[model samples]
Target: GIKGAFRTRIAYVVQTNGGQFPYELRVSDYDGYNQFVVHRSPQPLMSPAWSPDGSKLAYVTFESGRSALVIQTLANGAVRQVASFPRHNGAPAFSPDGS
Candidate 1:
């Protein structure tokens, strides 16, 4: 089994200057190898939180021209909008049991 902080994975964002997709949510090993994009959009993305089982990620995206919360399943690259409201939505996090 994987143990220790050094073996854990990390999620982060990258700004791609002058690209079709300007913002990217990516995952990588603790040492920064095997990096890959989990999601990308012309709009901004922020606050990536991993599920308890590490099967999904909850984040905020501005694709709708306003902040919205979404969840992405890692296995199939499926995304679903979880929350959308007036003004702003940000700082997504998963519950301890991922419910």
Candidate 2:
């Protein structure tokens, strides 16, 4: 069976220059190949976090015109916004049990 860190990919973010108007969150192999986008928005994205089992990602995005936390499931391209309030939301992390 696959074991250790190499068995899973890594997560990162890529930002374009001024006026590009959007940013992207990416996932790629640890060796820096097979890169692909996990999220994109015209506002901003920050605090990207990967699930303990590498099956999902939790991050902050300004897609709604305010900071909001979003969780994306890699297996089927499912996304759901969460932890949003009237002001700001960010710094998302998964519990040890992947809850």
> Which number leads on lDDT?
1
Which pairs of residues clash in candidate 2, taking residues 3 or more apart in a chain or in different chains? none
The local distance difference test score of model 1 is 0.88
Candidate 2 residue-wise lDDT, 8-46, digit = tens: 677877787766555989899988899998877688889
Q: Which regions of candidate 2 are displaced past 4 Å?
A: 1-8, 18-21
Cα displacement (angstroms), candidate 2, residue 90, comes to 1.6
Residue-by-residue lDDT tens digits, candidate 1, 7-88: 4888899998878999999999988998999998999999998887888988999999999999999889999999999998
Clashes of each: 0, 0
TM-score of 1: 0.91
